[model samples]
Target: MPGDAARPHQASLPPAPRNGLVPSLERRRLQAYLLFVAMDGFILLASFSAIAAAYLGPGGDFAGVRQGAEPAFLLLPLFLTIALYNGTYSRAGLTDWRQAGAKAIAALAISAALLNFFAFFAKMNAEFSRVVFTAGIVLTGAVIVAMRRFLARRLTARWGRGAVNRLVIQAGGPKFSLPDSIHIDAREHGLRPDRADPASLNRLSQYLRNMDQIVVSSSRENRAAWAEVLKGTGLHGEVIDEATRAIGAVGVVKHDDIGMSSLLVSNGHLGLRARAMKRVFDLTISLAALIALSPVMMLTAAAIKLQDGGPIFFRQRRMGRGNGFFAIYKFRSMREDDSDGARSASRDDERITPVGRFIRRTSIDELPQLINVVKGDMSLVGPRPHALGSRAGEKLFWQVDRKYWQRHGLRPGITGLAQVRGFRGATDTEGDLSSRLDADLEYLNGWSLMRDVRILLRTVTVLVHERAF
Candidate 1:
């Protein structure tokens, strides 16, 4: 810890709800987002329909006009999906009309290319009216951009310039404030960064319930603890410490109005757009895998159940993204009575039942975790999460390296770069943990959608590794 100054402890008290004064705008924001999306879709459809009518109305066949406008119907969903991922409907877009319009146009262009690509492959390009589609796309882009600007103006008039709720906490530090943000003194609120105090943590959580962003201005001694506390909350957290550059701040936000800058310490590896893409990929893959492997999962469950009348699924709390704990699900591999939940299994462990032995080795025991992935607790590709009790040699995983906590900067995955690179199995030594940590950091540093696909493809080959025990 860089700054380790002690502060006087205040009597613990629960954080009072701020919703009464701040009337949570979450619902209103959602409604605005939906309105933006609907308006975009409507404009797109109208543009295509008008173009089609102008091009083919002389034929006097309403069916022909509808058929000519089919491209818009196909393009609508593609454009919306891309727009959603690109943040066209995000809070930033809502507040900044320029961002909304730019993203919307970019999404429409990509969608058009994709639609054309699909049509070419399917050999249906001849069926679509080129004149209608080309003109429709142009019109749609212009209309959507204008619509977004108009919507932003209307929303701003209604809700003010700050589209998202921001809260700033001054914790015994120089005053740092932002316009359109709620400011409160930490000491006055009886808030302290005490990891040992569950009541204090709960109060902090309550204070942050609906906030989109949280900024803490803490004295040098308390920066590290505040950073840790913010990490577990999974929110976009910043600490007003210029020294954070040494500890790997993702980015910095300067507030000229207050003559202060905050270090963004807890922003996740992916931005909102990248997160949207990753989440979509996670859902698609997990749902498809669950459907494809349902039979395998059922049979495995039956075998484990019939082995000795024990529980079929083994559930344990594992660290997730943002340092939060989640119950990871795995098919029970070891006998219920003799299982050592805290220790990693050795080769040919006697505690592993016959059925458990087969599934664990083949990685079939991990199938149930697809449910966890679908539930948004895990991903298809990321650093493998370790049990809290998991260790390398005699020391716990985090104890082996201080940077170990950073491995959890992203959501834990079913298969990671380390696993595909042969870093799987029980960590028998510190190097084993280090190798995986290094790989995890590498993955986080250079994350891309294509790299995730590559890791997943590579994972298939190592599913039945010898070290899985």
Candidate 2:
């Protein structure tokens, strides 16, 4: 009954005669939601068992299951209600794991406080160990947060491509064709905006009605007219400037006169406190790491010297935060004369000494960058710095079409999300560099101390497994 009205033209057609539109209502999305609910139930049960075992003397069976049935029943519904109130189910609400974990912890804290108050009022606080309830709060919250992250990643990975929905764009102008230009242009941005004829407005409207979302792009002069046309068809749409849409869809924002203005007004600005906290975190972590890894750095320097009669350390001028040039420090992993401009190092680089190869593979060659981190020229986690004029030869690299220098917004890092994700070596093409930049932007947009810690932990795991160079 809820989505019956939302169904398109089903009432006009003879539905299998028994259940009109009922089967259509039970779509994959509905099934996914149901699956999520079941998963949440399983997480709750598993978490309760774990907490009981940890705090309830290990042998305290659920013999009082019937006696506690009413309380448990009330608690589950109440917890879900609180989660809903916190916007845990909303799109754009729980994207980051840190936020999701915080929300779960907050929800559990409130629920526990309320449950305890209820127990106190009912004079049954003595019946259960407070420790058991505390453990349940922590365990259940952790499971829910982790499961939510797992589900989010699965959904993003599956739906992030043009797999679930198809977008239809209707653009009529002297400069643009219906779908061909849109298809060619949008593909670069990982979008597939199919073209629809303006004359076929009815078909376009029907398509929009069935699609998950719709976006409209037109010249500034024609936006109002297009908006009216789309609204008349009873469909919601976003009107973006045709030029801006074209450029942004390709994921390239130039930092020129107009581009800089747009970015300044755009929502990409991280506020002052975030900037300050990030800087403080960089300083603290880098200083501590430099102190801790001093011995390793010394041994690396000695090893490089013993292996070859070359400089013990390598220093290359690299672009840092705000496009400032700084000399990046590394344990000299290749012969000094091997350097030929800003070429990327290959796995089997002939100039790499045997000792250098081992250090590079294990990432010990990057240890000296901790000094750069302490010197405030770099961060513990940010975009990896690139050498000046690094893309002189490759054709694909020439068409990078990105704000490559925007990576200088934060200090260059010793290790970053991109590096840990195996995008660290031999970025010989535009596609590879673009992917790395995307990961860097993702990190910048969602930077937090917890995220930094997680990245470090993951970096250690990758190091142990020799996953990257």
Candidate 3:
């Protein structure tokens, strides 16, 4: 049980992503959103380079006009950051070519306007050639937007070939059918989810590893069983009550409207304004940290490399916001070929290298996660990200408490209220995690800018906690 894998196979309304939609480079392997940022930035820079070369010729006419496109690099990160907020990097946002193009262009224009606004305020607009900047930026934005639209069409066209997401339904309230995009495997004809026995539920659990979108009816008898089965399985679900006329919204469903007959459930989380403020806070603090801690990070990297001639960074796949998966970065604190990365390290774990132990104790190992914070995968002050297979002494964290996931309502953080309050380290029992969740819920309920600052200030005291093995 300590080494058991996660389940709740991810299945959306349509079938899972088809093979052809992904590029040869990305075939089979999922690409992180940052890959899009890097690729698009390259495309933009290349377009600018071409335009600059053509206008200025092989001669160095640009050196006098702009002193080398220094502004471009600054602008690229800003544009990409804005694009992130505009949903250009979102999975749902990229599904539609037209919509993606519009969002990208709009973000690009806003970024350019802001750059010029800053330049004008600094009285530095005259340093660059207006013609080159205008032509290059406009062409770059158009080209980048067009390329993404092409990618979108390539991805969406795969579904046109009848390849869509598959669903395994066990509900028996009323036989519902979906479009061609979803293929249902209703194995049980009259199995009422509300009355499902443990044997049936256990059977369903086994198959859940390969299915998408699990749903269970909310009956007094089945509620706890459903929660237990779903817990720590990495599968989110809906509690379908018998009063529900339809299990899900069918034809003519108004956009985002909760209907009386709809079965859609709500787990209240951060509001939009709070989310926006959180993003701003993360970006600002991470940028400052990167600038402030560059030297320390470099020294740490060198130390790790010289220790065993092994990789400096250890990458572990962790769960992110909205139940999505992301690869997190940390300094290598264990043997390069260690067998178990998912398990928590004990006080005398022999796997730790001398340099690794020092860095881990100093919390220097977590510095690379500043990149995660910058990328919006994490927050500065929130719950810490956990590995997929992370568990307590013998049980997974989600199994420890029913409210474990409610903490995930916000993005995982580098330092949280729990860590500041001295709740860091391995959880040998359910109570250990329950105590941490109590602190987490308290932070979420009383969230404030000053509270975040105080928690951040308090985080320093727990950097060398007894849990840092």
Best by TM-score: 1
TM-score order, best first, reads 1, 3, 2
lDDT of 1 by residue, 60-117 (tens): 4889888878999999999999998888888878778888899999999999999999
Clashing residue pairs, candidate 1? 3-221
Candidates 1 and 3 compared by lDDT, better number: 1
Model 1 regions lying over 4 Å from their true place: 1-34, 37-91, 98-150, 157-160, 175-179, 182-211, 224-235, 243-245, 336-341
Give the higher-TM-score candidate: 1 or 2.
Answer: 1
Off by over 4 Å in 3: 1-172, 175-238, 242-265, 336-342
TM-score (C-alpha) between model 1 and the true structure: 0.72
Give the C-alpha miss distance for residue 9 in model 1, angstroms. Answer: 9.8
The prediction achieving the highest lDDT against the true structure is 1
Error of 1 at 5 (Å): 8.6
Q: Candidates' TM-scores?
A: 0.72, 0.44, 0.52
Q: Residue 431's C-alpha lDDT in candidate 3? A: 76
